[model samples]
Target: MKLQSTLVFSNELPPVKKLGEEILLIYDQILAQKSPSFGKWAKGISLKYPVKAGEHLKDIEQFPRHIKAITKLTEQTSVKKLTVVVVGGGSVGDFGGFVASILKRGVRLINIPSTWLAAIDSAHGGKTALNVGGAKNQIGTFYPADQIIMVRTVLMAQPEARAFEGFGELIKISLIEGGKLWSSLAKEKQINSKTLWKYLEAAVHAKYKVVAKDPHEKKGIRHVLNLGHTIGHVLESHYELPHGIAINYGLNFALRFSVQKKVMKPAEASRLFGEPVMGFLLSPLRDDLISVKSSDLAEYRRLLLSDKKKTKAATLRFVFVKKPGKTVIQEVTVDDLLIELCRQREEELHG
Candidate 1:
């Protein structure tokens, strides 16, 4: 269960958590060293650190409120041929990438992700999204970053909750891309910066396998990565849960549901989510289950209708489970789907 240091380059960058407010200056140093390598890729780079730090980590829902402030701060600076901007975390990257994508028809993006959630999952993916009204990530564009620089230092400063929040996404990745790597992580006692960086590489490779094969999500291959995201997104929109936490809960619920449907065996589901790893156990039960009735289902349907993944036909496409490392994208009716959601609510209450 011991993660290897050889698989990860420990000296590439300092730990991000320890940097704090000096992150901007630290990044300036990184840019100075890489100036030659990024010569053609970027004209100039700048860090727009948040003045009034938001309550939690940056999120897409808070974009509009801060966009004007952000715009004012960076507006006076002369435009470089290629401007590379660094944002704090996932939401920052999402909105930052979206803005960069549309600025003067598009500009280069260089992300320096700070959170474990951002480092391991959201930051690398080409997807950028923002919330609109009551739905989650209702507005977004598909845009890729020019480069993403990961410094292990950030993980050290990350709160324990966020570290575990990121761990949830990592666990999901392991379930899909299972091997000795996954098993080792599932049993690790102390997940250190070195171990986090090690799996970050593996998770990226695993995700790349799916995204490369189906970059646009037109094929069902990439959709499998959304295994728990279906119910997960709805929960996020309805409750005020953080994105990663909501997804963790959704993943647990989906896994349990899959067992109920006989789509996967209990033993297999248990192994991936059975025991707690680093005090972050993905339980098969929900503590605060909220039931949505037939009327509430209508509202839920409205949110689904507005989902970015929807098409003109507007059918609910589920990234449901078939087995470990195997998933199927099935289109389900809203009514039928709500029934399943209600069942999940009931299960959460009794269990």
Candidate 2:
């Protein structure tokens, strides 16, 4: 998993002229329309696989069909010389990166992530994943791309709403790798495209510091990356929220849970919450958990059970932060989670 090269492009098309002679492009058609320059570059592509980017793109049931079609598309091209260039957000990158890893027993892969979330988080990780039975990331591979391209023009074009959504990952990594990253981000006046761009390099480097420690996640060090993801994934599935948006609330939940468990003192938790940037995670979002009926606990349990990262039956290795840049893992059962949900709902509504 050698993450060989990363290229940044500002208001420019990817330097296609410098790429491999034989290229097989897989891009999001929706993006082609947004950036006409992308469409123009696509016009020169003789054999391109344009796909609609979404969770559906990673459906395992439909994957056999996709591979059959893609294999036939590349039958004439030299597999040895072919480079699979994946151009899109996370879903498109996941599907295309998987295709490159397996097709012809692993071809060269170049990733161009298009959204703020993708640019900041998913594209660099090299964790290609697909969903099954509507649960997220059920199947996946660790096929790092030969090159990752971060095109500023594509990221800058993202809607303002997405900036709010993408901030979840930025803060997650910032909190984990505290010190300078957290110090700088905690005082931020606004979290927008410009703010995201300013902190992108530090965020990515901080994530790599964590990832480099546990590349395959065999060691528990990588479990820190799951700080907000346990409950976050369940909320994403149950509420039909975007992954990044769900994570924001999930992070809030984790911080509170840390206090409840006595992992962090109430005063310490309050001090952390007092920071200006904490508002980015807590404000402007309604707590959907308050609407959950007592009867809905069973369904929530089912969703948590379906999470692939669960290490033990009926339990999750939940990440709890002691403070910024320091965390501890706690094994919590489904009943504990359900009880905490009720307690949190009450706390939010009453306070």
Candidate 3:
């Protein structure tokens, strides 16, 4: 399937003046301080909305006020020629993409992701989302961007530690699209800007391949992309871990669960874990993060139910890997997930 958005790579931010005569720039406010060039460029825009990037920025209750302000900001601009350029990391991309999708019933959207996480994952999927009542992604639209520009300088400007946050998605896609992508990534010894940049193109294309097959995520084929997100989200919301860091733990949990369920052969699991890149999956703070107590079961269950991917009252389609590139989905109840979480926590504690 052909990708809806045109993908471009550049060493620096492109001239947004040429994108449209009337442009509404929705960007992370932090970029003004983080990137001088971005700050200078933003000053020239006639209509721009600078936003704080995070889960709170996606709160649905805040949407009305945001839209009203944006409406007033673009009141005189011609809708036909209006373009929304989003610049930021995942949460910013999510908020901006949601705004672009609804503003004037949609506009030409271009995403210039400033962080590796957005550039590699969120920026490509065209999944715009907003949270409601503290539940993540409760309301959203499948509004693909008109263009996705990955600026090298913008991404590299992020702190080196941010590379660890992007590694989860990078490894997740490589594992799902296994063969050359997996083989090459598995041998890498470092998780840094250079390594991420080297694999960024392949990782984005790998995601588009899955999304193209099931663009709307109606078909279960796209569920493969949720490899580590299930438990990952739980860890993220509960522990307040960075999305990528939480996903790293989530991927670790899923791999162990797959082996326990006999979905993946022990030899295969062993081989995959033995890879050099796999070492980066577990942070030094794993014990602090993965130690879920029995008292926390109620909260964990609540999070699992709140998941948008839940199929019935308490069951969700969980993605399990049999091997790199081969995954299986199974419907597991909330209780089932909690039991597994406790079991994993125990195993981590003892061994």
RMSD of each: 8.2, 2.5, 2.6
In candidate 3, stretches whose alpha carbon ends up further than 4 angstroms from where it belongs are 1-3, 283-288, 307-313, 349-351
- List the candidates' TM-scores in order: 0.70, 0.92, 0.92
Instruction: Pick the winner on TM-score between candidates 1 and 3.
Output: 3
lDDT of 3 by residue, 1-351 (tens): 224799998898888677778899999999999989888888888788999988889999898999999999998887789999999998989999888888888888899999988988998878989998987788998889988999898898899999989998999999889889999999999889999999999999999999999888888788888999888988888888898988888888888889988999999989999999998887322466555566677777778887356544567888888998888899878777778877776676676
What local distance difference test score does each model get?
A: 0.60, 0.83, 0.86
Tens digit per residue, CA lDDT, model 2, 10-32: 56666676668788999998987
The sequence of per-residue lDDT tens digits that candidate 1 reaches over residues 1-351 is: 011111232333433432232112112223323334333222322444342222222355565565665455556544444454554567667766676666546655656666777777777657777665544466677776756666565445555656666767886787677675567777777655556767887887777767777665676677778867776777677666676777777677666667766777777766655545524644423554545666667666766665445543556666656555676566766655667777777766775
Clashing pairs in 3: none
Cα distance off (Å), candidate 1, residue 181? 3.6
TM-score of 1: 0.70
Model 2 has an lDDT value of: 0.83
Each prediction's total of clashing residue pairs, residues at least 3 apart in sequence or on different chains, is 8, 0, 0
For candidate 1, the 10 contiguous residues with the lowest summed lDDT are 1-10
Instruction: Quote model 2's TM-score.
Output: 0.92
